[model samples]
Target: MTYLFNQPSAFAAELIEGFVAANADKVRQVRGGVVRSTRSKAGTVAIVVGGGSGHYPAFAGLVGQGLAHGAAMGNLFASPSAQQIYNVAVAANNGGGVLLGFGNYAGDVLHFGQACERLRADGIPCELLPVTDDISSASVSEIEKRRGVAGDLAVFKVASAAAEAGHNLAEVFRLAQHANQRTRSFGVAFSGCTLPGATHPLFEVEKGHMALGMGIHGEPGIKDTLVPRADVLAEIFVDNLLSELPAGVAAAKGQRVAAILNGLGSVKYEELFVVYRRVAQLLASAGVTVVEPEVGEFVTSFNMAGASLTLMWLDDTLETLWHAPANAPAYRKGSVIVAEALSPAEREEPVQETLPEASAVSQQSAQRVLLLLEAMAQQIQSSAEELGRIDAVAGDGDHGIGMERGVLGAVAKAREVAARGAGAGTLLCRAADAWADQAGGTSGALWGVALTAIGTALGDQQEPDASRVATGVRHAREGIMHFGKAQPGDKTMVDVLVPFSDHLSQAVAQGASLSDAWQQAATVAHDAAQATAQLLPKMGRARPLAEKSLGTPDAGAISLALIVNTVGSLLHDKTPV
Candidate 1:
């Protein structure tokens, strides 16, 4: 979730600082996000550009030779305020005034309109050129409501160059709008994003499903569908975009054009390229030129899982800028038609699997515990919803559901080694690693703690029995409560923990044997779990669900109770617990 280059609120300013530090000779900041060249020719219409944050190379990156005259920067996914836009227009003014080129968003319109009004007050002429190239998949009744997307690049490049060449503001706006008219784009999303330090994701599509036509800021898409493979997905995306193009604009076999394959943050290039292959073929079949397209992340939307395709019908004038030599951190190009490529970017190293750090459990007994945990994981995998509903009474409705699925995933790896049956400690160690990686949240870590504690309880018991079972359950609860910071009265698993351990301990102390004590503990845990509703959440996720939990026990405590009862039931005469 962390933004790579700079902090959030400070990003716009730092990016400008870096831009000036690197290209002081080519561009200069004018006391705002706007940057201009000192030698901008007189009478040549100035191109004022801008947009929200995160799209590093787009609004700012394009502010170089043969591109924008200057750029007005804004916050993340937010439009530049009116004053910022006015500043850019004022600095870029050469008396002949400027052409303001930007994306078509409601916020952008509101801010830019005020900036234009302010400029008119100063007697400066200004024109607004908006890019609306996203061929919205919305139905006819909904088309007017769609937002602008990636096609802004080529269209702005064309618009900016027109101004740089001494074309009047009117003509520059004309060309920019023309580009918007000729260009079309569409996108789809799979998962969602997490702003830095966020504990949960901002949005969610569905398990194994994608929402086509989703916007950049976690907004809902036109529709959700089971994600198809790259080839089939490409056909759907490209075909939709093509249908919206003017009937014959790109229908000629040799009509030279360029295609931009954009990733919506965190999508891997290989997957993007796979989808592009379909786009390339689709364009070829329809008689459009793809022109050795660039395939990489351009404009991104945080960590959302999706991508968009923007195809611009190009002429020699637009094609020249597309081929122009340029280089910026996020976007790059070389005029050279042929050359040996530079060394490739480094790949991320795979994580090595090794035993985790834990001392309570030894390598032997841990393995047997691993077998038990894995078996339990499989049993709960399909019960996420059922458990979730049970927890709904006294805990977060998701506790049962999340735990069921989370443990199953963690067990997948743990079971593999356990199937061969190693000692308890070794298996527990492996299980701990898998649980943390796959389970992902507080519950996952707690499950791992339980596994390690079981290893500790099994200690030197060569042929473990009910006594070992009771000891392990007690130790496991201790670990969960210790690190989790939730107690019995706090409406957590401790509710059942206190009763379960006490029953088993007393039974053993009063001359009861392992079988009888284990059975008593199971019965105690179930009723105690149901009793959690008597307490209010004083800690953990259940606290939020506490008031709602009134009249019911915490789901986690209940779940802990269920798990212990199950484990205890397996302990019997002449059998290892």
Candidate 2:
């Protein structure tokens, strides 16, 4: 359990500050994360890796020469915001393009994908290669759906090595993808990890029993059984991983592999070495050669009592990359030639966005937006716990907290900007930035994009007519779909958004009043959210535990319905045109 913390929310930031101070020779503090203090060769493809902060060496620890150029560190067990990812990548980028790599998780996918889009729009070349190495999350046929775990090391190392070797962006991306395809990992936990300031773990294991197929996020394991002896546990780990070999590998015999016996957090090195003892014997018996075996904490959950074994099937290229010299703060390989330290530069002031002038009529509508934001915030606060419970059925149970954080931030920013006489578009754009920054998750990014799209449609210079409002809704729906990659039947907020936008557009085109159109759209969204209970989730973190969510509405969809209905109440009471 994590016992050391001043404020739970501030833990990640504080930790990063300390880490940078302790490793000033190797890394420098950036706005979003840490970047290499040592200079890189000009025009080298920068490899940026990141994820939630709880996993130590998996992310920030790997930032240095011949490893990751930078890392976008997020709050405990939560993915970083898109702005954070973009900032880190910007700081790390030399003249060459950037290759972003991380675990295959929902929040990471959304944020990294958004950063890639923004980077490309700004003419900075970027690509993403999400590592999918945990075999238990999905079947072999559905490997892309699997979650990444300890095997992150294998993929990141290969990609960083390729980049350091002067490989182009395309070649580095290909090597990262190939490494991910050839890696497989399996794990078990004696107990779950406790997040900072939390009294209990995310999930519990029965006493005297062990949970199998555990992840690095403190998520409960897929299966549970009696705790085995050290040798027996090693046997279980090896068997599960060997059950599914990488494609083109006919058998374990005569195959060379890189083996990592990793402690989750609380598991000590002595315990891991005991397990590895049996692991080595079994591998030798199977005629599989283990090369450069690593036995210690590499990737870890916060005080989680568990361990995992990763096997990366190696070819000649992989072997060369795997053995390449690295000089990170935490992990070091063969000796590396140090480059000159980065030149000291004065910090630049952040550029402020200029707000366009607004018409008096649009300014009045902006006040109405402030009211809407207040109502939405109140509704989210009241429903947060229920939303979390629903999400916990098949996902990490943070949706309620995340939504409440985002809505409250949006309301606060809207209130501040409205007080400054900002127009609807300006207020919403500021609020969008605040929401995404505070929430820091998949939902946060999608919500921020949706709100920004709506704000764009409602220009500051004109009055917001019914047609324009409908257009804004349609724009928001499209933005969410494009950024989140979620369709209506995926049982996400998109299910509610699609119907709501369609109904609003149809009603407004049929000459309905703004209030009337909104009422009809809210009804459609509410119904769509309820219908999600009957549909299986086909995306996001819930996809792995799809069956468990059979009778529960998606937390995101339900929250969308709640906010829309709350807004409907305010619209009903307003003066009708």
TM-score to native of every candidate shown: 0.54, 0.94
RMSD to native for every prediction? Answer: 20.2, 2.4
Q: What is the Cα-based TM-score of model 1? A: 0.54
Residue 104 miss distance in model 2 (angstroms): 0.7
Off by over 4 Å in 1: 3-12, 22-25, 137-145, 247-255, 315-577
Tens-digit lDDT string for candidate 1 (166-196): 7887777787777776777888888877655
489 in model 2: Cα distance from truth in Å?
3.6
Clashing pairs in 2: none
The candidate scoring highest on lDDT is: 2
Which candidate leads in TM-score? 2
lDDT for residue 108 in candidate 2, whole number 0-100: 88
In order, the Cα lDDT scores of the candidates are 0.66, 0.87
